[model samples]
Target: MTAPTPIVLLHAFPLDHRMWDEVAAGLARTHEVLAPDLPVALGEPLPEPALEHAADAVAGAIRATGPGPAVVVGLSMGGYVALALLERHPELVAALALVDTKSTADTPEAAAKRRQVADAVQEAGSVDPVRAMPDVLLGETTRSARPDVVERVTAWIGEQDPARVSWAQRAMAARPDRTDVLRAFDGPVTVVVGDEDSVTGTDAAEHMVAAVEQALLVVVPRVGHLSAVEDADAVRSALADLAQRVHDPVA
Candidate 1:
């Protein structure tokens, strides 16, 4: 029998690999799932504020898993890193799942806001500046109906080191557009977004889908930016299907 394909889970910013706990657990039953915390996560030393650094970490993780490419699933900031990884180390990726993320670089105003948040976080020596992100990161349905999830997201943000938060924010601000990376990749791609994800909603997802040849777009209902956390089942199902396509491209 053939070995199950490896799956690498890259997490969103201001959060750790733990954000993928539920989805990783579900996928691990059928695939080798590896969720590595990005740079400065879990008390690691701060690296240069660049997505390439994060992508290198992911490449190392994939290499450690053994030879051959792994299915890469990245959410939000993770998605940016995933695109970077694809551009820098294409051979390590068998397929990709981009969830609640966009391939385009942040606009000038958005990048400026990120820098401002970073500055505030560093000056305050706390993750307080981004503490209220759940309001924008989560959909109205989740905020009103799933208080536990909202609290969980808030707690994750609180757990991040202030300096690391600043570093991540700046790193994201410095990233460039990678849609061409997707256009060049021959592997199957899955684009997932919460129907209510205001940050990178359906429009962004559609843009990514149109960039790739074999792309699957999944717009999950009643969720928001953190679709994987808000609706793990939907995300899990989509990933499992993507893995299957990777395992049997001709099927």
Candidate 2:
């Protein structure tokens, strides 16, 4: 029997571990899977000033498993956390699947917008960003046509904790550019994004592809920001293939 590679899946911001449920189920047959929620309250307050909280706390969850290395997959905020895992917990990350995320740090204008929204949400509610996020993240087509996708996102947003969202926003605003993490690593990497993922689109995946030595890029069609929900089958296939490449490069 082939030894199974450990798979640790990190979810996007505001959403919880459940976001990876379908994809995890697909990868489970061939690998051991761990999915942890990233609620600020659930873990520690999202690191102040930058990604400080992310590297240690989130990556430490995978580290606690006692494995030398594991394939780490993350989406959006989850992708940020995955980069954190690679940077601070290199020994614990054998490979990486960066889904619907970018390697560059937040731009000052973007970071300022995030801070402004974070402030407004503190006074209002996390739901405000949750509602508007789909517009910014998803393509115009997905927003107009996909009701099920819309419903799933609505459910996810409704469940998030406001304080957690507030903290994560600030954390994201302060994170350093991690493009070097991809360029410097000597390991397998895959960058997956939905075809219509405006928030992190083909451009982001292309940047990632250029950086990693052994990397694959996959873009799911007719989907948007939420690939885990919008194009889960595509996501599953990508992860399965990535796991195979990591486990047996020749196979």
Candidate 3:
């Protein structure tokens, strides 16, 4: 029997690999799943703010597994790293699942806002500046119905180091557009978004889907930017299906 394909899970910003705990656990039953924390998410000291560095780390993790390519699943900031990894180390990725992320670079205003937040976080010497992010990151439905999830995300943000938060914000601000990279990739692609994801809503998801020739778009209902966290089972189901397609294209 053939070995199960490897699956690399990259997490969203302000949160570590723990964000993928549920989904990873489910997928691990059928695949070789690995969820690596992006730079600073786990309080790792990064020399500079650059998603490229994070992508390099991810590439290294993938390489450590074996010679073959792996299926890459990224959410939010993780998506940026995935695209960067694809551009810088295309041979390492066999398929992609970009969730709650966009393909375009940040707008000037958005980038500036990120820098401003970084400055505040650095000056305060605390993650306080972004402490309220869970409110915006989560959907109205979740905020109202799932207090546990809200508390969970808030706690995760609180655990991040202030300097790391600032570094991640700046790093995200500096990322480039990678739609072309997606367009060039002929591998199967899965684009997932929460209907209530105000951050990078359906529009962003659609843009990514349009960029890729073979893409599956899943618009999960009633969740927000953190679809994987808010609706792990939905996200897990989508990923499992994507893996099947990757492992058996004809099936």
Candidate 4:
């Protein structure tokens, strides 16, 4: 008889573990949830139009924290890192929960934008890019209902080390598309999105669910790309469902 495994939460770009405060409490009732911040960005100027290093950075975090395989929950940039973690250390992740993110690489145009953002963050010595970034990342409807969520999210991003912020941008811009990660995983998977999420819509969530035979997708209406914080209840319920699935794969 072994104790239950913990649930692991990975934070999005320019954010630390704080992003999952609501989620951590929600999941704690039944499952142990651990949230680790992404590395603070610092160091050399970002590579032009590329951001592959963040993946490696995230993989290191996963390996260091786990005593055994843990259910991995990742949001936005965190989701990208989760994909890379699964690819690099498959045995460490028992399941994956991807919220408001897709498993695809950046397009050339998207990559270029990433570089521009990195440069701006580096020059300004701030996470303003991350703060302003959500406008495009999340939907307009969300901003209308949950003004606090923006502050919460922006704070997470703003606190980031400018280099970490810049580095994360570059890392994301450089990584390969991860659709295959979804297509290949056989374990329990949860794909959640805010109904109002125009950045990565429900369509992307469904594609991920379809890719993994055992995957489940939950859409939180009136919520935006930051579904975890925007609709904590929806996220909690979904995690509970995922926990049950992991606990009883045959069911």
Cα lDDT tens digits, model 3, 46-102, are 668989888888888998899889999999999999999999999999889999999
Point out where model 4 deviates above 4 Å. 40-66
Instruction: State model 2's lDDT.
Output: 0.80
Full ranking by lDDT: 1, 3, 2, 4
Writing each residue's lDDT as its tens digit, candidate 2 over 107-134 gives 8999999898788778886557666565
State the number of backbone clashes in model 3. 0
Clash list (residue pairs), candidate 3? none
Error of 4 at 27 (Å): 1.5
Model 3 lDDT, full chain set: 0.91
RMSD of each candidate? 1.5, 2.0, 1.6, 2.9
Model 3: lowest-lDDT 10 consecutive positions: 38-47
Alpha-carbon error at 157 in model 4, in Å? 2.9
Number of clashing pairs, model 4?
9
RMSD, model 2, all Cα superposed?
2.0
TM-scores, all models, native as reference:
0.97, 0.92, 0.96, 0.87
